[model samples]
Target: MPIHNADIIRIFEEIADLLEIQQANTFRIRAYRNAARTLQSMDKDVAVLVEQHADLTQLPTIGKDLAAKIEEIVHTGQCQALTKLRQQLPASLPELLKIPGLGPKRVHALYHELDIHTPEQLLRAARDGRILALHGFGQKTVDALVRSIESHIRQKPRLKLAEAAHYAKPLAHYLQQHPGVDEVTIAGSYRRGKDTVGDIDLLVSAADSQPVMAHFTHYDEVAKVQSSGRTRASVVLKCGLQVDLRVVAKPSFGAALHYFTGSRSHNIELRRRAQQRGLKLNEYGVFRGDTQVAGATEDSVFKAVGLPWIPPELRENQGEIAAAEAGELPNLIELRHLQGDLHAHTRASDGHASLETMAAVAKQKGLRYLAITEHSQRLTVTHGLNAEQLRRQIDQINALNDTLEGITLLKGIEVDILEDGSLDLPDEVLGQLDLVIAAIHSKFHLSRQLQTERIIRAMQRPHFSILAHPTGRLLEQRDAYDVDMPRVIREARQRGCYLELNAHPERLDLLDTHCRMAKAEGVLISINSDAHHPNDFDNLTYGIGQARRGWLEKEDVLNTRSLRQVKRLLTQTL
Candidate 1:
């Protein structure tokens, strides 16, 4: 029943999409989109803000009109404006937008021209050769759309890591506060910090099981109780995330945690090892011929098989066991080792916060430096800075740096990589900044060869320092554009340019496998927040999880270096 920030953002975004389809004022549609973005980056809950009598208008880019809508939605769970727009348009037409390669313009044309309102209709139209007759729809586009829509329908619901945490963390805390509950751990992919998770597995160690199960089933967010038992239960949260809880004795807690927080293959391999050692391992404990030898803790389970405790993120059966046995397991990079963020935005571009606010938050978070990478002129929708604007921002950063302490703001730009494989901004302008983060804003549907070459060519530019969101993926909404990443990684190594592991939850860009490849090629990765707001800096944890999954270490990350070292490395790229 609670209206979460995600809920509010979702509604606002739908309103924007519907407005766009209706050919409404560009500014009005953009206002809703901007407000949605502000909500997405906000750290606090909107309901809590309302409860605290906080002014919604105070939020960045949120105006009086948008604030009223937030209040309406938070209090009533629906927005009249959004409802009105839905009535004006075919309600099912919005569903079409979820399909990849189907944007507002394409959907609008399909709706008016073909009366296609759903994936079923669109698929039929495509099959009947009706879609290709539309202005922008071609045979390739039709084929891609059919594949995307079919795949979208077949895919199971999953939550991004950050989205899952919204439910998982609070639920864990709730269970921890229950009477007799001692320890609570969320296992499964959530513990492993997978980019996306199917469900949350909660393990609670308690003196009694009834209290834990009762408390979990009655939690405010439990929308449906799938199953309930004395020591175990399964429920679906209001946010549509399924949670399974198991109560275990304190002594068997670690074994349970290890078993539940597993990559199935990892557990299979561990069990095989235990069998070789003439021991048995499971959720309950480790046993030697029915005489319980170890299981009180995960360390004991691993120790019984002569191994050290492996971090959950690395428990993918991806050579982690062999590495642990050889004592070659990497001392994975932690959040504390990060010294700075090399890619961020401010009000100078599409980012919600100001330079001062972002810098202060970065400093507050213990960062020594934060780069202010505004979008370059090519990205007009973001109101990207031209040469003059960038020069002024660079000057502003310099002035701010002189007046500040503890944190230095680096001048930079997330310059667009033109289709012809050139940096968006001219070299003379780019030379004025501390770093240049090249990104692809348009033309995501390029061939793998061209896409890879486009990025590699951009990296060859003298001032290009890092590739932002190398794959340009938007989690569930879109797939990564075709690109030969191995070639890109190798090119980065040869060019002395770096690759970014974008920390933003929606775009944890460097795939784990790609991160591993980058590391092996001696190409350092910058685990940057690509932050648009101050709180966006908190997304670094997701990036850290991804880095660990990729087996990256402190030495392999770029921003983990001292400010001086980072500067030296950027110069090397130049």
Candidate 2:
């Protein structure tokens, strides 16, 4: 099987996890972690680059040694360094890292102190109160671990939408190249733009199922062919993503797509509506008694049900049917609807690109304005800006704006919202910017009431404009902090502040439900790229998907307004 970019990244991540567990060189461990992140964000396939003999070290954060390792993995399908580490560590030790609160340090301690190498053993230790005696494992920590372990055991693994797309797009394209394949569509939660996908459901229209099944099962990325038959095949990819392929006739393509791209609740309601009309709906077509009424296209299917075609993103049975019936479905937000980005980063903080580079990319992307919201001093790890640095940056932005055309740069800071509800920077310092984005960087484990109060207090600040990544959740990594978001949304409305839908793949915060809640409270959302590099601007596409899923309209988004209008709104809070 041909090694894929995702496959290489997975190996790097595992190597990093194992290295950390073995108390290896910190820099070596960090190199692997950084390499994995760099690969994950890349749109280009590293395997193809290796085949082209391209210099991988030219990529971000990739050193010559790491680049060689990547090339080795791409060609050999495994890394000898990772294999060596695996020899010294238990194979299941890295799996413990997936459980929240179990860092490498703690896992090391557990392994040496109690010989708990697997989750089952860890669970037994926790249950026996053995874990509580460890250096850092208190009763509360043990309880949390027990709960997390049980949840982990029960839940099937899911990939983030962006991660899933990394694997899905190439496979779909490969299928399209098949000789007899006419149409190929990816259904399931992926089609609905859900933040996470459990698996990929691919429906294809082909003249004969035999050729299609052969082509799919023989793909280079397939790690295992679980099943192969005339009309359907299921395969697990090297990256551990399961893909189910089904072949449908051209006449039934739309119906099959509709059936496969479903929330069960939405499908049930549609079937109920079909029943009311004395018709039967199935994967093949809509039938009135024995005669076919509609099936050629998705629009025809909806028309047969006496409704307009609802966008897949809103097919959650969440009042979408009612809205469609009333002809009141929103023209949901799209990537093109955005006029500007309200949050971005530069080399001034932890970001990788220069301010000019970021602005140029935004201009190329047809944006009217871009906010440079670098981290404030409280986040020292990012070399965050102190008062003097922020003042200098503000002046730099002012000078740059004077020379630039077609795109304006807005001065802003992602100032930390302290535990006591205080802004990281002084009011006088914050007052100088075009806007202020307050965020909770620490104290994530606070009580819900405290977390809510902390954010509300920040919103009360006159210069506060938006709450960046409002929930502070890193998808598939850390859960969202406990906060009364409904209360926060209402407070934001009262305070004339906005909230951000961070477009960064890992932190697509201000989730769909929160976006809807913000809309209900009349608070505008700023769907921002939170661009740290030029390529990062592309992440806005995911944000737009999330906005559409939330049923947001152009009007519900703050950056959809013109620059002047945005300026006016920014000043409202002040």
Which tens-of-lDDT digit does each residue in 1-574 have in candidate 2? 6766778888898998988888899878877876777787678888899999998887877899999998898888888988998999899998898887788999999999899899899999999999988897888778888988998888799998988988899899999999899999999999999989999999999878898999999999888999998898999987889999999888788888899999889999999999999999999889998898888688899999999999999999999999999999999988899999999888788777788888998999999999999999999877789999999999999999999999999999999999999999999999999999989989877888999999998899878999999999887667788899999999988888999999888888888999899998899999998876677788899999999989899999999999999999999976
lDDT of each: 0.90, 0.90
Predicted candidate 1 versus true structure: per-residue lDDT over 1-574, tens digit per residue: 7778888888998998998888889989999988877777666778899888898888878899999989999899899998988888888888888788888888889998888898888888888899888887777878888899888778787888887776788789888888789999999999998999999999999988997789999998899999999999999987788999999998788889999999999999999999998889999889899788888889988998999999999999999999999999999999999999999889888888888999999999999999999998988988999999999998898999999999998888999999999988889999988899999989999889999889888988989999999999988777899999999999998998999999888888899999999999999999999887777788898999999999999999999999999999998877
Report the Cα lDDT for residue 440, model 2: 90
Model 1 local distance difference test score: 0.90
Model 2: what TM-score? 0.96
TM value for model 1: 0.97
- lDDT of candidate 1 at residue 255, scale 0 to 100: 87
Query: Which pairs clash in the backbone of model 1?
Result: none
Off by over 4 Å in 1: none
TM-scores of all candidate predictions against the true structure: 0.97, 0.96
